[model samples]
Target: MALHLYALAILMGAIMSIYIPMISQSARVMGAAVMGNVPFFFVAFVTSVVIALVSGQRGDSFRKIADVPPWLFLAGVMSAGIILGATFLVPRIGTGALFVLLVTGQILAGLAINQFGLLGVPAQPMTLSIAAGAVLVIAGAALVTFGAVT
Candidate 1:
């Protein structure tokens, strides 16, 4: 059941990877009309609040913020950068291209992160199969970026 749900979650993420940029492109236009050059921040602020409300209530009520390493705190900062970058780039490159590039980057970075155990995670040595899979993903991304999506 857990594995099924995880697969469903990945499917949902794939759907959102397409859907979100369309909404964000519209929001970017709205933000430009209402605010100035930094509409993505406004959109990000609202998104953060929604995410916090959904996530914050589910966990232990008395978690200690101070116990968390300061380095781990950068996740939110990184999320903001991703959101803002997507908002800026999706309109310029189109969603297919943007996500192809993004996924390619993610796979590459994930491979490195897993291999090195960077950011304090348990290191998993990169195997030949993993490298082959990563290469396949890159090739797929290249096709998605360059080929017609229809």
Candidate 2:
């Protein structure tokens, strides 16, 4: 099940890679990158509602919402900030550079998260192999962002 979820995450990542560029274009057309979130969240909200209803868990979900600590809600704020930043940066830095940097950042954060088991996630002590992989990813990001075009 974990492998299946990982595969799905990879697929979703690919879709998001394309989606951000489209959002950047839409932001260009709409005259503000932040404006892109209006339609984005509208669709997200509708889809989430439909999913909750379809799962017959809408009431349960709503009830459980209060069980969540207030700090957990910051995830939504972080998500909005990410989308808004991507919408703004994609146009200026190009998708390749932006995603390279984003992925690099994600890898670094994941390493720390796994290292300390932060946010209730299971701890995975950082190993030499993992550290090397991160170093390579950072190097690749540098190449993508700073390398000269031929």
Candidate 3:
């Protein structure tokens, strides 16, 4: 439980830090996209490798990748697309608005994923409360995006 809380705190800090440098992140992601994902992925892969090596928990996960479903591998592609898209959108929409829309999309996608029990997760039935929460999120996104307009 303590480790979970620590991880959650770190995640929250990371999220906050990302918004502070969103423009730089966007530019870097765009540059990476243009230059080819190999360099970008290589850097991130090496960083992960170093971290794993230092942590002393370097399991044989890579060796077992072939055993996992092929669709699981698409996460890398999806991550690249998301990074590129966020890079393009953040400048146009502003970080706060972009984050609102992104969070809304994430919640909706999560709801669907949970509903269908995708990726080997247990099925989590979506109740009316969940639907209502999703609706509220969309409404909040709209307000964040358009509220300033006359």
Model 2 segments more than 4 A misplaced: 1-3
For all predictions, the C-alpha RMSD in Å is: 4.5, 1.7, 3.6
lDDT of 3 by residue, 15-53 (tens): 754843454464666674334434556788999988877
Model 2 lDDT per residue over 1-150, tens place:
599999999999899899888877878889998898778888889999899888888677889989999999999899889999999898778998998899999998999999999999999999999999999999999999999666
- In model 3, the worst 10-residue window by lDDT is 32-41
- Candidate 3 to truth, TM: 0.75
Per-structure clash totals for the candidates:
0, 0, 0
lDDT of each: 0.75, 0.90, 0.74
The best-first sequence of candidates by TM-score reads 2, 3, 1
User: Could you tell me how far off, in angstroms, the CA of residue 94 lies in candidate 2 after the best superposition?
Assistant: 0.5
lDDT of 1 by residue, 1-150 (tens): 599999998998788696557556665667752232245456767887688777865345326566888988799788666766776777778888888888899898998898899977799998899999999999999998987757
Superposed Cα deviation of residue 126, candidate 2 (Å): 0.7
Best by lDDT, which number? 2
Angstrom error at residue 67, model 1: 2.9
Residue-level lDDT for 53 in candidate 3: 77
Instruction: Tell me how far candidate 1 lies from the true structure as C-alpha RMSD in angstroms.
Output: 4.5
